[model samples]
Target: MSASSLKLRMMIVTALFAAIIGVLAQVTIPLPLVPITGQTLAIGLAATILGWRYGTLSILLYLALGAIGVPVFAQMSAGVGILFGPTGGYLFSFIPTALCIGLYLEKTSFNLKNAIIANIIGMFISLLLGTVWLKYIAELSWGAAFASGVAPFLIVGLIKAVLAAWIGIMVRQRLASANLLYA
Candidate 1:
């Protein structure tokens, strides 16, 4: 493919992933402070499959859609308020989460092991950042933040990480084999 066509393909894929993130955001198990949503899983998948550049682009696109009131955020929430709300830290953290996950795979290899490691790291990053945000925004004590934000999500996050790694590697391999993804 020509450079232009490749760029177009990447853009299309990025947009598609953004939409996927939005769709997955609705898969929520509600909680008091922040619900457990499939957003992180989608983030992991994007990073593992798309690498740093496109993965981060997809996250940025997703954020932009939500900021514009597209109702793409968790529980179909949207607008700039959500970006600045109590759960906003998690949303903001997705950028670095995706970047780190994708970069790790790009630096090492896009395999299930590396993807799992990367996603686990991404999970911690999100938890840490989101907890801090929740603490201040929600006026909760650090203990409360840890209890609600970090503690509850650990096991679930690990499960999602593994799933993302497994599924992402499979899909990535297929895409590469089909000449749909560049190395």
Candidate 2:
């Protein structure tokens, strides 16, 4: 298929979203085991807007930027070494989480309900990776990891998922009306 000029726009928006994600992710609420932040919300929004390939690239870019000590990450630190930290799971998980959200929307309409379902599923993917990393990297037990890494964020996760879905639908509507999408 031919490339769309929208790629350029997507790149700009992706960068903006990455920065937003990084900034929003700063307010980490420490849990009994892991910490929670609004990073997933940014991931969801980026995926919905950028689609799979660019969305994944955007997250990877964010990670790479952080790795270079750009302070573009949640905790304002950077480098591959930070991957061993407590919140590392969520950071790594963002790539695949974004892929899932973007890929799903590529084939289907992104309604609020569908976006919610997609974001929930994507978040589950993120939580699974994050929790596993918490257990391994953080040297926590599985039970404890689940309790801390996943449990406390459940309610807020749901809320973020809903918000992501709603935001996706709204953006889609706006794009369609403005003829920003393929006409």
Candidate 3:
């Protein structure tokens, strides 16, 4: 593909993943502070398949949409207020989490083991950042923050990470074979 074509393809793919993330964010179980959502799973999948650049771009776009009052967040909540809300840390963390996973996949081979490890790393980083955010925003103690923000999501996060890794690698492989992936 020519340079312009490649750029267009990248743009399209990025926008698609951003939409995917937005849609996935709607799949949530309402909780007191941090709801369980499929957003991270989508983030992992996007990062693994799109690599760091486009994956991060996709997440950034998704966040931007939510910031501008799009009903793209968990339970259809949106606007800059959400960023200052209790769950905002987790939402904001998606960018770095996607970058971490995408960078890992970019540096290493896109295999199951590598994908899982990358996803795990990304999940942990997000959880840590999110926990801190929760603690301050909610004015809770560290233990309370972990209980409300991190503990409940641990198992679900692991499951999503594994699933995202497996699916992401599969998708990446297929896209690469079709010459549809960016470098």
Give candidate 2's error at residue 50 in angstroms: 2.0
TM-score of each: 0.98, 0.88, 0.97
Model 2, CA-based lDDT: 0.78
Tens digits of per-residue lDDT for model 1, 6-92: 778878888999999999999999998899999999999999999999999999999999999899999889999999999999999
Task: Tell me the deviation in Å of residue 72 in model 3.
Answer: 0.7
Quote model 1's TM-score. Answer: 0.98
Q: Which stretches of candidate 3 lie over 4 Å from their true place?
A: none
- Candidate 2 to native Cα RMSD, angstroms: 2.4
After TM-score superposition, what is the CA distance of residue 157 in candidate 1 from its true location, in Å? 0.2
Predicted structure with the largest TM-score when compared to the true one: 1
List the candidates ranked by TM-score, beginning with the highest. 1, 3, 2
How far in Å is the alpha carbon of 31 misplaced in model 1?
0.6
User: lDDT by residue for model 3 over 1-183, one digit each (tens)?
Assistant: 798887888889899999999899989888888999999999999999998999999999999999999999988889999988898999899989999999998899789999999999999989999999999999999999999999999999999999999999999888877877764
- lDDT of candidates 1 onward, in order: 0.94, 0.78, 0.93
Model 1, CA-based lDDT:
0.94
Clash totals, every prediction = 0, 1, 0
Rank list by lDDT: 1, 3, 2
